[model samples]
Target: MKTIGVIGGMSWESSTEYYRLLNRHAKARLGGHHNARSLMLTVDFAPIEANQRAGNWTALGDQLADAARQLERGGADLVILATNTMHRVYESIEQAIDVPFLHIADPTGNALRAAGITRVGLLGTRYTMEQTFYTGRLSERYDLETLIPNEAERADVHRIIYDELCHGNVNDASRAVYQRVIDELAARGAQAVILGCTEITLLIKPEDSALPVFDTTALHAQAAVDWAIEPV
Candidate 1:
């Protein structure tokens, strides 16, 4: 078995999910008590969020890359960033670490492609939806086109993420908001939707969507667990 490295605590909300899903998947795969062998580097979220507010990603990237390298030193075979927004500096993090970084976009793109979907709607942090790194990686690297909610709708998306999800509050009203986003995406010709933020699966699921939904967090973590448990 290989050790999976997790670069988490971007909000601790989604990172917690990553930790749980990895273990649950490993247990299901290997046995009742089986769990993944892992190394975790949890960075402070306050400062990262502050950096996001200030648009000072250089320092943030430096900090995240350092964490990645430390995880490698701690014996991680692969690194999972655990949050979609943090992937803005993914290339820098990858260059700093020795282990292969499991890109959230790859499995997602592969899954969407396998399902033969050409266009997908995306919902996440304003940064994840509006920013280039995440969506660009999916488009440029994976050859997938992503449709994001319009400008005014994005504030609502950001609110749902921070005001509710970041605090672990899942409500029916929030689900309704997400459902509306999904519907709007479908109306606009999106064949599917991607939950680009890790914590979003807690709010809206495929069950609530008319279109296919890609839960990037789940896909990314599942791949990590598979790598962690595969025989060396």
Candidate 2:
């Protein structure tokens, strides 16, 4: 198996999920006491969060780039950025490493396409919801129409991600609020709902919404597993 590198800890809660899922899927597929050949370089979340809040991506990108180089140097064959919002720096981070950085957006978009989803609703952190960096890539690169919740609902979703899920507290009440948002999105012509926050799939599931749900975390993890097991 190829070594998969992880640029993680935007919130280690979701990062932990990435590691677990990678191992779970790897063992299931290869059928042994196998775990993913992995290298994880976890960044300090406080500074990264502060940088995002201040709109200073230069330092954040530099930090991630440095981590990518380290993961490569540590014998990682492929890299995966373990957070959705932090993928804002994906381009620069990709340039910093020679190994493949499996974009969190690509596999999710591909999964949506494979499921026949054309228009989709997205729930994520404020930066991810409002920015063109992520949604633009899905729309322009993958030809998917992305619909974000309105400012009010967006704030609620963002709060749930940062103040709740990121902190490792999954609240049932939060899930109810998101369920309403998902219904509204389906009414707005969304064929599916994309959990753009890696931590969200932990709170809500497809059963919570009337439409199909594509989990960014699981799709990204599965894609990484597939790539890791491929012939070197």
In terms of TM-score, the best-performing candidate is: 2
lDDT of 2 by residue, 143-216 (tens): 99999999999999999888999899999899999999998998999999999999998899878778788999
Count clashes in each candidate, considering only residues at least 3 apart in sequence or on different chains: 0, 0
Alpha carbon lDDT at 173, candidate 2: 97
lDDT of each: 0.87, 0.91
Candidate 2 deviant stretches above 4 angstroms: none
Question: What residue pairs clash in candidate 1, if any at all?
Answer: none
What pairs collide in candidate 2?
none
Q: What is the lDDT of residue 151 in candidate 1?
A: 88
Residue 208 error, candidate 1, Å:
1.6
Each candidate's TM vs. the true structure?
0.95, 0.97
